[model samples]
Target: MNATDFIVSRNDLQQCKSIETQPPEAAALPADALLVKVTRFAFTANNITYAVMGDALKYWQLFPAPKDFGNIPVWGFGEVIASKHPNVAVGETLFGYFPMATHLVIEAADVTKRGLRDGAAHRQVAAPVYNAYARVSGDPAFTGKQGDYQALLRPLFMLSFLVDDFLAENDFYGARRVMLSSASSKTAYGLAHLLHRRDGIKVIGLTSAPNVAFVKSLGCYDEVVTYDAVTSLPADSPVAYVDMAGNSDLRERLHRHFGGQMKYSGRVGLTHRSTSPEEPELPGAKPSWFFAPDHIRKRAREWGPGGVDMRFGAAWAGFAPKLDQWLTVTEGRGPAAVQQVYLDTLNGRVPPDQGHILAL
Candidate 1:
């Protein structure tokens, strides 16, 4: 049998690098680690952030890999084919940031450190400490119910909860309405939904004209406006702009339109591009980036694990149902199809709110 298995790769920027032609010996699993045979992975905005931001995010390039290798894009799910760790055994299916390859040997320590989610019903163990993990549901098919789809919202909800907690505790410096770009995206939608639950704050969602209705369909925002409708927004609106679209021009336009009213601006993502440094801060507003780990670390120290966990649990439970409607799945491992999907996502040609599941 041929040893090579197709692996999607990118060289630099958004270009499709090419299929790596190599033998199984070249991608060998460590003797002491479990080897996951990858079967599927979902393309979320979070992975897009990693692909695009690269070395910009803190501790991104700081971690030491099994070998002295360059940075690897960490996200995906798979099944275990081999294992030396007692906790992980042969034939156990797992999901986490395994890799975007046919098979990957993940150290047991890395699994424990990074987190993995498997379910008993699915003949696996679910360790969601690093990120929420769920049972793949009792029914084989997507049942469209909350329990049936908890995995869809777990990661996204954690981010949304973290964002809400940050804004609630921090001093916005006198900002009222929160301007959320990528309003149609799942992450942004999660934020908009959570913030809308309580009164007194306004959620202004910004997206393209095509997604305007879909964004409004979420029914969580006080106002839904298109990107081109920037000028139409209230000038000097005294608002906080939460940027989700990493487009420099849009960030500049939002800053210019709202000006001093844009009291606080947080750079959360560059979902539009697969390779670009974090956007330069907009002048005038208090600018910084939002990272879930940093926020969780600080809060965990101050509030302790119990308090933070309880709060986060409630937030996750609240947004659980809404997430199901936002996911889209695609099958096949055709080189051309995967290439097109990657290019489309990088170019912002894909719909902002829809999630993509890639079947390998």
Candidate 2:
């Protein structure tokens, strides 16, 4: 391909416009630099967060934006077409952070440092949480040698695993029923799957009716409840809640229903709202923010190398098969479809039962 194609975000429709082809040249940098061709990127909640939160996050101060137009941060698998670095060579595949753009050029120096690089290095950085690069692994966790679609899902699985860890670490002493808001969302479904089989935990999934049957098909919850039907729940179930919906009203209802028994409330995502307002008066059961980057970092330090290896590595292996079964892939990465996908996602128009893949 002589020209690289990409989707550029435009304010016109709060949408992305496709740049079908662009002139491609030999390494734009020194000989040691590597040219990476983006393969597939999942339009994930985290990336959406980067777009929506934009310049507002407190941590955004760490990574200054290069331009005013909101940055489109993406994570996906790619192939190295050329490389001057010995560690990475032509034809090698890797997984890492990339912009929504088609072709990316990185110096060997930047490639090697990856996660360690600060905002000063990779300008226009949004989240300090993600590493710049992830070397594709032959480990069994990534579907053997090819990685395939499975590699794209590693980040989602890792977040679910870490959420599980957070519950465990907090001791969950008084925790009883667990309410999963945004029950139709992929992340919520996965978390519910991981916890459903546990001996005593009761899983309650709160979603819309369109998603009710689909979520129930997953069979990972003790009960699937719709947001409108939440009034049917026991007024005092003494529950712990996971708020993925980011709907303040639902958050309030969960707090009120469980009241004092609401032992723990975790806020993991704001999928429902493009941008959520700050809660001046948080509800009865205060929602604790579960930032995956922070959780992983703390665990890495506390568990050391061996601890991380045992927990995350083991979690990845165990969860891989189940994840693959549910993560259905969609084809093509044209920008025209991307805006529709986002719109559907925003209005809860996308089918809750399936996962999405935007092949670039």
Best by lDDT: 2
> How much does candidate 2 score in TM-score?
0.83
Q: Can you write out model 1's per-residue Cα lDDT over 1-360, one digit (the tens) per residue?
A: 121132223235444433343324423655456656666655566666765554454223322222222223434456667666666657665555544456654545533432443221211221234333222323332233332233345566778888877887764456668889888877788899888975678899988888998888888999988888887987755788788877678878878777777788887877765324465556667567886778877878899857887887788767765655655544446446555666676567777655555543
What C-alpha lDDT values do all the predictions have?
0.61, 0.64
Judged by whole-model lDDT over C-alpha atoms, candidate 1 comes out at: 0.61
Model 2 Cα shift for residue 9 (angstroms): 5.6
lDDT of 2 by residue, 1-360 (tens): 543333324232254444545524655546566777777766655455555554455323332332333336566666778766766767766676666656666655455522222223454344444534656544443343225445445666677788877886775546767889888776787788777767788889998877788788877889999898886888665678888877887777767666677788888877766434766454456777887878777988998865865876676666666654555656546665665665565456666544455655
- Model 1: weakest 10-residue lDDT segment is 118-127
Backbone steric clashes in candidate 1, count: 2
Q: Listing every candidate in turn, what is its Cα RMSD in Å to the true structure after a full C-alpha superposition?
A: 6.1, 3.8
Pairs with backbone N, CA or C atoms under 3 Å apart (clashes), candidate 1: 52-274, 118-126
